[model samples]
Target: MKRKTLREEIFYKGIGLHKGEDIKLRLIPAENGGIVFKRVDLEEGKNEILMDIENSFDLTRGTNLRNEFGASVYTIEHFLSALYIMNITDLIVELDGNELPILDGSAKIFVELLESVGTKNLKEDVEEIVIESPINLTVGDKHIVGLPFDGYKITYTIKFDHSFLKSQMLEVVVDLESYKNEIAKARTFGFDYEIEYLKNNNLALGGTLENAIVVKKDGVLNPDGLRYEDEFVRHKILDLIGDLKVLNRPIRGHIIAIKAGHALDIEFAKLLKK
Candidate 1:
């Protein structure tokens, strides 16, 4: 398949996940341009920030991208994951804030939007990176290893020291159908006890039962309950897909992650650039 871009522009506005600010985002077609973030709020040069790992910073709650001039866009993983699985290689995302809207804390809404607005194939072929050898990065008990594979796949394992989500693991062959049906709806989760701490630190101000799965000490507080029996692991895989976008191309490999997060995921991406 050739590279693809959005067929038409789409607009969205909602609450930012981190700073709780209202944000607006627009998706526009780009013939052959890869993913680029335009800070409509900035009134200066270099508001256009490429989604590259070198520009990533502050891996606190989500993936953040910063330009040399210090302009930034935060919490981009969910949006990036949607674009990755959609097989979109060229597009322009214009946002009028420093962070993206939380939007239920899953990629489902974005996936649906992309499906409805649709995509148009560009003339260029997608740039891709295929793992030809094993690559491993580890820090303490957290690790993400990539091995040679013909196509993209991931086996993620999350070990939570809690009764509700003790240990959950899943393996997914990354594709549009699998991503949408399996990973996209798995909401980002957090412990109920941590809400006050997160808020006091000025983070996750927009987080709520509506946007995330709130896990109590031994159960969940979300009225809807779990989407998948092992939604936690599925969400980890979902995040891996998004973090991998820092490669700026499609990747074909077998990835195994153990208790990983944005920091470790970005570390792996950085190694791949070497």
Candidate 2:
């Protein structure tokens, strides 16, 4: 099938996850086969940086993209995940800062915003990355594997030492229609012990009970509790899906992941690309 791109302009603004600064993002349609990030606030002579696998840099708590010009964009997984799930083959992402807004700490808000504006289809065929061989990576007892498949499917299992989390498994068949309803609403989560550490280190500054699920040693800290029974593992699957989107193409494969995080996710993507 021919690829699809955004049909209209969509804008969002919020605070950055790490920088704790307000940021603005605008998604506009593009007629080609690539995604580009335009740093509109840059001074004269600086050019817009395109999003590509080659530009992928350090995989800390989030995904960061950079170039020799020192221009960088951080925590792009959520936005990229939305785009990938929507099958948006080309786009021009205009941003006024170095990081994407951490709106609600999940891709739900972004998905809603995009759907409100509606999507446009292009006259081109969609291209996908069909796995040709088994790709696997292991770290301790945690591992991730990708095998050839007809479409995109992900089975993620997370094992937490906590009593509440323990071991939970989630399998999602990722597609444009199901992404918003099934995966987008899963919020990112953190441990109660990490709150002070994150704040002191200037990470997850915008996080709150409203945007994320906070788990205490004994149980959940949120009054409303989890949105899903296995929300923690589901959110990990969400993050993994977002991270894998960095490949810049819809993948046709089955992924089995165990206790994987950003680092392992990126490592798996790197191996898949090779």
Could you say which candidate leads in lDDT? 1
Give the whole-model CA lDDT for all candidates, comma-separated.
Answer: 0.88, 0.81
TM-score of each: 0.96, 0.93
- Each prediction's RMSD to truth: 1.3, 1.8
**For model 2, the run of ten residues with the poorest summed lDDT:** 43-52
Which consecutive 10 residues in model 1 have the weakest lDDT in total? 121-130
Writing each residue's lDDT as its tens digit, candidate 2 over 1-274 gives 5667776888888888777788888888888847888888886446466777778788868887876687888888888778777777688888898889988878888877877877677787666778878888999988999988888899998888886668889888888666776788888888888899999988887777887788887788889887888877777877888888777777889999998888888888888777
State in Å the error of residue 15, model 2.
2.0
Model 1 stretches with alpha carbons more than 4 Å out: none
> Considering every candidate listed, which one attains the maximal TM-score?
1
Task: Give candidate 2's root-mean-square deviation (CA, Å).
Answer: 1.8
